[model samples]
Target: MNPARALIVDLPGPDLTLEEGRFLARHSFGGVCLFARNITTPERTARLVRDLRDALGHDALVATDQEGGAVLRRLDVPHPPTPMGLGALRDPEAAREAGAVAARGLLDLGINWNFAPSLDVNVNPGNPVIGERSFGSDPALVAELGVAWALGSEAAGVMSAVKHFPGHGDTQVDSHLDLPTVNKSREALEACEWLPFRAAVRAGVGSVMTAHILYPALDGERPATLSPAVLTGLLRGEWGYDGVVVTDAMDMRAIADRYPGGVGAPLTLTAGADAVLVCGHGELTPHAEHLNAVERALRDGTLAEDRLQEALTRLASAARRFPGTPRPYTAAERERDGAQVRAWARASVTRVGQVPRLSPDAEVLLLTPDQPGVGGPYGDSLGGDELAATLRAYFPRLRHANYSPTDARAARALLDEFPGAPALLATPTRWNLTPVQKELAGLLPARGGIHLALWNPEHARALPLPALVSYGFRPAHLAAVAQALITGEAPGVLPLAAPEVV
Candidate 1:
């Protein structure tokens, strides 16, 4: 075959265009990674994928970042608990079940590849990008739960790409905008960041997605995706991982800012990346240009033929390994998953210290951050709408305001108008605390205030007790926080150590 599926491109929307079909045929693309916009419903997504494959006239992978909680492509459907929530549950069997269920849904949508089960150990409280995606801070726990999740996914025939390999959890910078540096010594990396990945490989994860982070200890200059030392030497040579290695989105500033004109495609292939991901809807380079650039690299010997064939082999082997048995998630499965998620919220949300109840007759103000648009990467970060809808049931007079740093002064003034009314500040993310979240929680009067850390328990300590760490902002999790604030009855314990639970 003259064409080898070496590239993974994204679609512009749910329906593939004629130009898109032509592009797929021209280059023999390996796969398409669908975003939220491409997924409206299971029926529509399945049709779109079928049409895509008919155009190619070849087998191709369909993927999405369907990791539960924060990054779900199918938002309309019920999902199991996030990795952090599952980590709190500490039941590897439960983690495996979540993975199996997610895989089934993905297969129903005609998706076979899932970029998920982040093996990153989130030890840094300041990591902006990977707060709740990780299973937990402890490497051992992350390894156990992550492997269980991955094994479950693979067993169900949907391959899991355990990601941001060589770790993206310890950095402060978001790779979407810039490259982050992880300054840990090799020894420290071995102890923390590398453990879960090692475990994933040992447990036979099908794929690994390389991080866009720079580890100076591994390679002095280049980021992991472009560094042979990290990808080829460490991952392939040392760890004996012969599976496919997919680079994270090439459009991200971490890669794009450094390599212009789609030159990174050849560089990544040279470095051991199997798939060159140039995402649609936000790609910088023209489609033809990326293909042209790779062709030129080949002509110039920058990309060796053997290297190209080797990468293709790995990608092909993955499809053969996890040829899924596709089945739609039944209505019963949806309700079952919904109940499991609700149970998780009930069992994992932590109440710190004595949470004071607000009088039903008193005025109450809830400050929250806004959720990103449905297609954005952090779409579910702030489920403020979900939280407010639930909280309104408890406090009839409750007024909710989406606040930014500019609204800090107004939020404080709004609190003063109520005199003795309690003001509640809720943050669904830890490292991602918006400026307004920090300022308003600080501005609230020490006595008549409630702070809810909806994602992590430690971040709740930023304010005072009388706070609840709900561990998530899903409808069920936020409902528990709403119930706890009004009745002082949060029952879930923190996955991590925390202060007294009310």
Candidate 2:
């Protein structure tokens, strides 16, 4: 295998380095997975993508993680409610629109492949990586929403890779950190976690990304990324997933921690993965090593010729299928799409109890998470910025106090200053509150306004207050929550299942 054509690596910055440019030329590794560092502005991004395509040809697989709401490489793009948030809406139109909007934005930046519509059913609240990233806990809901999102994205001229195949939702441990074992039988897998993948396959998803987690029921020792039983037997043999099978970042600890020095290359390819995402994190050394390992195995007869040919054929087929192109939305289309997203946000923000009615001049205290510059669910850049500005716009006399949820004393002090004054408190997460935050929530006064749970709706049930779930952290999401609180017209049901606390 040619290292240049075989590897999908990352550049050091927005502009390609001399080595990167030379390496990414035709017959080389032109497949570049973008990250935050590679993005600057729309013009710069389009230019960069154009340059790469010019060098690598139109079929070059240029990608980025533009999964709406948080996991984004380009902040300039319009991000709709996260998959979990869309799950709360459970509207196929909304889900499809969200995907289309995100894909259109990415395509404007000349990114043809979006690793999005994460199909993992979010069953484990403690799952660190795939919580809000996933659609939701329910299998049917996830399947419906995920497939809709994928189709919409594909229609927008961007290849939507429904990811973390066979599900990465139930595991508590993050595969990015270490190996997470999902101790479920094949029957159990078929019933819950695997449903979305099944739906995606049936719907003719162009690509399926393998998860890093180990399922003992499928294979004894190997994770899904390196297991033939999971990738070849189940995905290819049984389900007939003829599309490309990409491994989820071989540099991730789930693969890297076990097979040091690019050992996973031979294992992953032989296990039936069509593409190995090893070079995206900006380390070319390991990528070179992986290529060398693959070449050595091929020459030594350790890795069979049939497996290599299968992977190459799949990659070629994918290139023919997805000729990377920019699909810009018209100005009117952009505005209409934006309106649709805002409408969906309004529709998805759910109210659980009494939504406090504070006057425009009422001295209402607003307690929000102090997320500083953090992105994703923490901040849509949500914390203390968009949320404060939106709520403040509604309630001019709003007394906003930002608090670190992890630091109880700091938040407690903020509460002390408020002194039982009716306050709008928002706690954002896809899981339960931090013990400290939970304690703080309990200590709040009875009429502590409304508990606005952005991503973690269940936490509102635990707080000693009525709750409203925005199910998102985008500015529009915050605006929707404020609208609901102001007008008392919120209409959304929490997507997750469980009894509400008294």
Candidate 3:
């Protein structure tokens, strides 16, 4: 039987060391999942994947979380910003095209598998982890767009893994912090949460990743990751999902905190997961310990060897179906991809509120959140530089500022610079609105109109502003917003459940 082993390795940056690559190969890991930290340039990333395949042989799965929008892992390389931006287009055709573009980009980077096209329906607008990463609020729309993306990605020769099965969209708490429980009945879950995943499976998605959330309707005491009723019974039996079922990061608080005897990986596989992604272990020591534990379980007959072979066979079959090829993009192909990125970037713009026409020569102020210079728990490089570059291209006379505590001081400074300039708050969603920003939103009617560009809408919802606009944090959105404000054009209308706020 194939070895009961899988690996989760972090790329230092842009490429992997020969030693690191060889280590993974010698260990015979099932796969490696890439994060933003592993990417730098397209060429370098492609070379890294090539080296990994060469070292690990053709059977290894090279995967990335290239879901687009908020969950996008590669930004140093050229690609559109987020998934919500594409969802805002509300056109399945557009979503398909974007998926094709993303697939081509991933293949160019030497990645054969994508942990993307998040099937989680964004039911809770305030969900901390899934905000702009989700397609939209409606389950039907999310399923349509997500299925289109899966089909497009597969067509482009990359296997797609639909994620957070049993839904991670409705919870307010992030599973990264602790286990989140979904108290909805099976009927309610089937109607709202399970629809998108069911649609994805019907579309022939290659894989499904289990969520860490607990569903009382499925299993009262265990999270979905450890619940056979949820994974094997519900997903595999009831829904007829025969594809490989993988667990989300096993190191997440939900699994690590609750697992008995720390046998999370063994328990996960026993519960019907084909693979366990143990991310954020930091060093090889912890990873080696966990892998050893799993191996021991197999030896002791605690983890059935048949289950391990089944998982390895599915993983190998998938690798063969989507075989590795070094299709390094040429200059012409790169240029074409660049153009598509720009177009999708434009399509993602969502104008949540009306903005009155401003004079062509009117000065505009741009304010962005003060992201840490070095990335910490949330990952580094929050796209602040990219936002600034996009803004400068659109607004030639734009003035900019990083977020600060002294809102009165900052606002006064901007007022001093351009006495009549209109202010536009262009920021990634933060935990809460600054008092200055909040006061400014309230004062917009008395002064001039304030336009808010939400990189993440969950952050935007924190402030109750009437004239708020949302851009899924794509460069094209910035350009489109700037043009719409300069000219007398109505931005694309937000789909409203309630009456229009006019």
Which one is best on TM-score? 2
In TM-score terms, candidate 1 sits at 0.91
The TM-score, computed over Cα atoms with residue i paired to residue i, of candidate 3 is 0.90
Give the TM-score of each candidate: 0.91, 0.93, 0.90
- In angstroms, how far off is 170's CA in candidate 1? 1.3
**Over the stretch 1-502, how does candidate 1's per-residue lDDT look in tens digits?**
2223777888778887787777677677788888887898677888888876766543677788888877778776676567887877788998998898788778877788999988888787667778678888888999999999988988877999999999988888889889999999999999999999999888879999999999999998999999999989999999999888998988888988898778788888899998877785644244456667778888899888899989888877877776544577788988887787777777666667677776767778887766533222665466666777778888888887776645565566667677567788877664545566777767675646788887655677666446877766677777766666666666665554333457
Clashes of each: 0, 3, 5
Question: What is the full ranking by TM-score, best candidate first?
Answer: 2, 1, 3
Quantify all predictions' global Cα lDDT against the true fold.
0.78, 0.77, 0.70
For candidate 2, which ten residues in a row score worst on lDDT? 372-381
Model 2 accuracy (lDDT, Cα): 0.77
**Top candidate by lDDT:** 1
Instruction: Put down candidate 2 lDDT per residue, 114-202, tens digits, no spaces.
Output: 88879998777666777668778889999999999999888877888898987898887878778999999899999999999999999
- Cα lDDT, model 3, residue 215: 96
Model 3 spans with C-alpha error above 4 angstroms: 6-14, 260-262, 372-389, 405-408, 416-419, 458-470, 488-502
- Per-residue lDDT over 304-408 for candidate 3, one digit per residue giving the tens place of the 0 to 100 score: 988787777777788888885756656787687777776665555555544566665657776665662322123543455566667667677777766564445
As a whole number from 0 to 100, the lDDT of residue 102 in candidate 1 is 81
